[model samples]
Target: MESLSRAGQEMSLAALKQHDPYITSIADLTGQVALYTFCPKANQWEKTDIEGTLFVYRRSASPYHGFTIVNRLNMHNLVEPVNKDLEFQLHEPFLLYRNASCQYTVSGFMTRMTVTG
Candidate 1:
Protein backbone atom coordinates (compact mmCIF):
# COMPACT_ATOMS: atom_id res chain seq x y z
CA MET A 1 0.00 0.00 0.00
CA GLU A 2 2.73 2.40 0.95
CA SER A 3 4.65 1.57 -2.19
CA LEU A 4 1.67 2.28 -4.41
CA SER A 5 1.15 5.64 -2.75
CA ARG A 6 4.82 6.47 -3.15
CA ALA A 7 4.87 5.73 -6.87
CA GLY A 8 1.96 8.15 -7.35
CA GLN A 9 3.86 11.01 -5.76
CA GLU A 10 7.11 10.32 -7.59
CA MET A 11 5.23 10.48 -10.85
CA SER A 12 3.93 13.97 -9.96
CA LEU A 13 0.46 13.33 -11.33
CA ALA A 14 -2.50 15.56 -10.48
CA ALA A 15 -6.08 16.30 -11.49
CA LEU A 16 -5.59 17.86 -14.90
CA LYS A 17 -8.86 18.44 -16.81
CA GLN A 18 -12.53 17.54 -17.08
CA HIS A 19 -13.95 15.21 -19.76
CA ASP A 20 -17.21 17.18 -20.20
CA PRO A 21 -17.85 19.84 -22.77
CA TYR A 22 -17.25 23.48 -21.83
CA ILE A 23 -20.79 24.56 -22.69
CA THR A 24 -22.45 22.15 -20.27
CA SER A 25 -24.60 23.50 -17.40
CA ILE A 26 -23.50 23.57 -13.78
CA ALA A 27 -25.63 23.31 -10.62
CA ASP A 28 -25.53 25.71 -7.67
CA LEU A 29 -25.82 22.97 -5.05
CA THR A 30 -22.17 21.94 -5.49
CA GLY A 31 -21.25 25.60 -5.85
CA GLN A 32 -17.86 26.61 -7.37
CA VAL A 33 -15.88 23.93 -5.71
CA ALA A 34 -16.38 20.90 -8.13
CA LEU A 35 -16.09 22.85 -11.34
CA TYR A 36 -14.75 26.14 -12.58
CA THR A 37 -15.50 27.53 -16.04
CA PHE A 38 -12.43 28.85 -17.72
CA CYS A 39 -12.28 32.38 -19.10
CA PRO A 40 -9.33 33.02 -21.41
CA LYS A 41 -10.27 36.68 -21.46
CA ALA A 42 -10.10 37.36 -17.70
CA ASN A 43 -7.82 34.45 -16.68
CA GLN A 44 -9.69 34.10 -13.41
CA TRP A 45 -11.78 31.62 -11.49
CA GLU A 46 -15.27 31.45 -12.92
CA LYS A 47 -18.02 28.86 -12.49
CA THR A 48 -17.64 26.35 -15.30
CA ASP A 49 -20.54 25.45 -17.51
CA ILE A 50 -19.30 21.82 -17.58
CA GLU A 51 -19.09 19.20 -14.87
CA GLY A 52 -15.75 18.11 -13.40
CA THR A 53 -14.25 14.71 -14.10
CA LEU A 54 -11.77 13.04 -11.82
CA PHE A 55 -8.01 13.41 -12.29
CA VAL A 56 -4.78 11.88 -10.89
CA TYR A 57 -2.89 13.17 -7.89
CA ARG A 58 -0.10 11.80 -5.70
CA ARG A 59 -0.62 11.46 -1.93
CA SER A 60 2.31 11.17 0.42
CA ALA A 61 3.41 11.15 4.07
CA SER A 62 7.04 10.41 5.09
CA PRO A 63 9.61 12.47 3.24
CA TYR A 64 11.92 9.48 3.07
CA HIS A 65 9.25 7.09 1.76
CA GLY A 66 7.84 6.65 -1.75
CA PHE A 67 4.23 6.93 -3.03
CA THR A 68 1.71 4.90 -5.02
CA ILE A 69 -1.32 5.70 -7.13
CA VAL A 70 -4.91 5.04 -6.11
CA ASN A 71 -5.94 4.89 -9.71
CA ARG A 72 -9.43 4.96 -11.24
CA LEU A 73 -11.41 1.75 -10.96
CA ASN A 74 -13.02 1.58 -14.38
CA MET A 75 -10.11 2.98 -16.34
CA HIS A 76 -6.65 1.54 -16.04
CA ASN A 77 -3.76 4.03 -15.97
CA LEU A 78 -6.50 6.69 -15.65
CA VAL A 79 -5.97 8.08 -19.15
CA GLU A 80 -9.75 8.31 -19.72
CA PRO A 81 -13.16 7.77 -18.14
CA VAL A 82 -12.56 9.91 -15.06
CA ASN A 83 -14.84 9.14 -12.13
CA LYS A 84 -14.62 9.94 -8.40
CA ASP A 85 -16.06 6.75 -6.86
CA LEU A 86 -14.51 3.29 -6.70
CA GLU A 87 -15.84 -0.18 -5.82
CA PHE A 88 -14.05 -0.15 -2.48
CA GLN A 89 -13.16 1.98 0.55
CA LEU A 90 -10.08 2.09 2.81
CA HIS A 91 -10.75 1.98 6.55
CA GLU A 92 -7.18 2.56 7.72
CA PRO A 93 -7.29 6.30 7.23
CA PHE A 94 -10.97 6.60 6.31
CA LEU A 95 -10.66 7.29 2.58
CA LEU A 96 -13.14 6.60 -0.18
CA TYR A 97 -11.96 5.23 -3.52
CA ARG A 98 -14.00 7.47 -5.77
CA ASN A 99 -15.00 5.67 -8.94
CA ALA A 100 -13.15 5.19 -12.10
CA SER A 101 -10.28 7.44 -13.38
CA CYS A 102 -8.98 9.35 -10.34
CA GLN A 103 -5.77 8.37 -8.58
CA TYR A 104 -5.32 9.79 -5.10
CA THR A 105 -2.33 9.23 -2.81
CA VAL A 106 -3.14 9.09 0.85
CA SER A 107 -1.50 11.68 3.08
CA GLY A 108 -0.40 9.30 5.79
CA PHE A 109 -0.10 5.72 6.93
CA MET A 110 -3.54 4.25 7.49
CA THR A 111 -4.35 2.39 10.68
CA ARG A 112 -6.42 0.02 8.56
CA MET A 113 -7.45 -0.51 4.94
CA THR A 114 -10.97 -1.40 3.75
CA VAL A 115 -12.51 -1.97 0.33
CA THR A 116 -16.19 -2.42 -0.67
CA GLY A 117 -15.38 -4.65 -3.62
Candidate 2:
Protein backbone atom coordinates (compact mmCIF):
# COMPACT_ATOMS: atom_id res chain seq x y z
CA MET A 1 0.00 0.00 0.00
CA GLU A 2 2.82 2.38 0.89
CA SER A 3 4.63 1.64 -2.37
CA LEU A 4 1.52 2.42 -4.42
CA SER A 5 1.05 5.69 -2.54
CA ARG A 6 4.65 6.65 -3.22
CA ALA A 7 4.22 5.93 -6.94
CA GLY A 8 1.14 8.14 -7.12
CA GLN A 9 3.01 10.97 -5.37
CA GLU A 10 5.94 10.64 -7.75
CA MET A 11 3.59 10.79 -10.77
CA SER A 12 1.95 13.97 -9.49
CA LEU A 13 5.33 15.52 -8.82
CA ALA A 14 6.46 14.77 -12.35
CA ALA A 15 3.28 16.28 -13.81
CA LEU A 16 3.76 19.46 -11.81
CA LYS A 17 7.42 19.70 -12.88
CA GLN A 18 6.43 19.53 -16.54
CA HIS A 19 3.85 22.30 -16.17
CA ASP A 20 6.12 24.67 -14.25
CA PRO A 21 6.98 27.34 -16.78
CA TYR A 22 9.48 29.13 -14.55
CA ILE A 23 11.67 26.08 -14.32
CA THR A 24 11.51 25.24 -18.00
CA SER A 25 13.57 27.25 -20.48
CA ILE A 26 11.77 29.84 -22.59
CA ALA A 27 12.94 31.51 -25.78
CA ASP A 28 13.63 35.23 -25.92
CA LEU A 29 12.09 34.99 -29.42
CA THR A 30 12.72 38.15 -31.38
CA GLY A 31 12.78 38.95 -35.06
CA GLN A 32 12.55 36.01 -37.52
CA VAL A 33 14.40 32.74 -37.66
CA ALA A 34 14.99 31.13 -41.06
CA LEU A 35 17.27 28.72 -42.86
CA TYR A 36 19.18 30.25 -45.79
CA THR A 37 20.50 27.62 -48.19
CA PHE A 38 22.62 27.76 -51.33
CA CYS A 39 24.42 25.36 -53.62
CA PRO A 40 27.58 25.63 -55.70
CA LYS A 41 28.29 23.62 -58.86
CA ALA A 42 31.73 24.03 -60.41
CA ASN A 43 31.64 27.68 -61.47
CA GLN A 44 27.93 28.23 -60.78
CA TRP A 45 25.74 28.32 -57.69
CA GLU A 46 22.23 27.17 -56.82
CA LYS A 47 20.10 28.51 -53.98
CA THR A 48 16.78 28.07 -52.19
CA ASP A 49 15.46 29.90 -49.16
CA ILE A 50 12.42 30.48 -46.96
CA GLU A 51 11.72 33.91 -45.51
CA GLY A 52 11.39 34.39 -41.77
CA THR A 53 7.62 34.79 -41.63
CA LEU A 54 6.97 31.54 -43.45
CA PHE A 55 9.66 29.83 -41.44
CA VAL A 56 8.07 30.91 -38.18
CA TYR A 57 4.63 29.72 -39.21
CA ARG A 58 6.01 26.37 -40.34
CA ARG A 59 7.73 25.96 -36.97
CA SER A 60 4.48 26.79 -35.09
CA ALA A 61 5.78 30.10 -33.77
CA SER A 62 4.18 33.54 -33.86
CA PRO A 63 5.60 35.61 -36.73
CA TYR A 64 5.32 39.06 -35.23
CA HIS A 65 8.55 40.54 -36.61
CA GLY A 66 8.97 39.66 -40.32
CA PHE A 67 10.90 37.62 -42.88
CA THR A 68 14.70 38.01 -43.03
CA ILE A 69 16.20 34.91 -44.54
CA VAL A 70 18.18 36.10 -47.51
CA ASN A 71 18.85 39.41 -45.83
CA ARG A 72 22.05 40.09 -43.97
CA LEU A 73 22.55 43.24 -41.95
CA ASN A 74 24.99 44.45 -39.31
CA MET A 75 24.32 43.37 -35.77
CA HIS A 76 23.20 46.89 -34.83
CA ASN A 77 20.41 47.23 -37.43
CA LEU A 78 19.37 43.60 -37.20
CA VAL A 79 17.18 44.54 -34.22
CA GLU A 80 14.75 46.73 -36.12
CA PRO A 81 11.03 46.22 -35.70
CA VAL A 82 9.95 44.25 -38.77
CA ASN A 83 6.35 43.31 -39.44
CA LYS A 84 4.70 40.40 -41.32
CA ASP A 85 7.10 39.55 -44.17
CA LEU A 86 10.20 41.11 -45.67
CA GLU A 87 9.38 41.80 -49.33
CA PHE A 88 12.84 41.64 -50.86
CA GLN A 89 14.34 40.08 -53.95
CA LEU A 90 15.69 36.55 -54.05
CA HIS A 91 19.43 35.94 -53.44
CA GLU A 92 20.02 39.60 -52.63
CA PRO A 93 21.79 40.59 -49.45
CA PHE A 94 19.89 43.00 -47.21
CA LEU A 95 23.01 44.53 -45.88
CA LEU A 96 23.51 47.20 -43.29
CA TYR A 97 25.66 49.55 -45.28
CA ARG A 98 28.71 50.30 -43.17
CA ASN A 99 28.44 54.05 -43.86
CA ALA A 100 24.83 54.51 -42.88
CA SER A 101 23.59 54.35 -39.30
CA CYS A 102 20.60 52.08 -39.82
CA GLN A 103 20.42 51.66 -43.57
CA TYR A 104 19.56 48.28 -45.12
CA THR A 105 19.99 47.63 -48.81
CA VAL A 106 19.37 44.45 -50.78
CA SER A 107 22.28 43.88 -53.15
CA GLY A 108 25.06 41.45 -54.19
CA PHE A 109 25.00 37.65 -54.47
CA MET A 110 24.85 35.19 -51.63
CA THR A 111 27.41 32.52 -50.81
CA ARG A 112 26.69 29.10 -52.31
CA MET A 113 27.03 25.42 -51.40
CA THR A 114 26.26 21.97 -52.84
CA VAL A 115 22.47 21.50 -52.96
CA THR A 116 21.20 18.06 -52.04
CA GLY A 117 19.19 16.17 -54.63
On TM-score, the candidate that comes out on top is 2
Q: Which regions of candidate 2 deviate over 4 angstroms?
A: 1-60, 64-85, 91-104, 112-117
Q: TM per model? A: 0.18, 0.21
Global lDDT of model 1? 0.28
Could you tell me which 10 consecutive residues in candidate 2 have the lowest summed lDDT?
A: 51-60
* Candidate 1 Cα errors over 4 Å, as ranges: 1-33, 49-80, 83-117
User: Local distance difference test, per candidate?
Assistant: 0.28, 0.28
Query: How does residue 68 of candidate 1 score in lDDT?
Result: 27
Tens digit of lDDT per residue, candidate 1, span 1-117? 222344543332322213222212111111011223234587654532333223222213212111122233333222222233334455544333333444332222233332221
Candidate 1, poorest ten consecutive residues by summed lDDT? 23-32
lDDT string for model 2 (10-116, tens) is 55334323433122211122233333222234443222233231101111223332222322332211222233333434443322222123322332333321122
Clashes of each: 24, 2
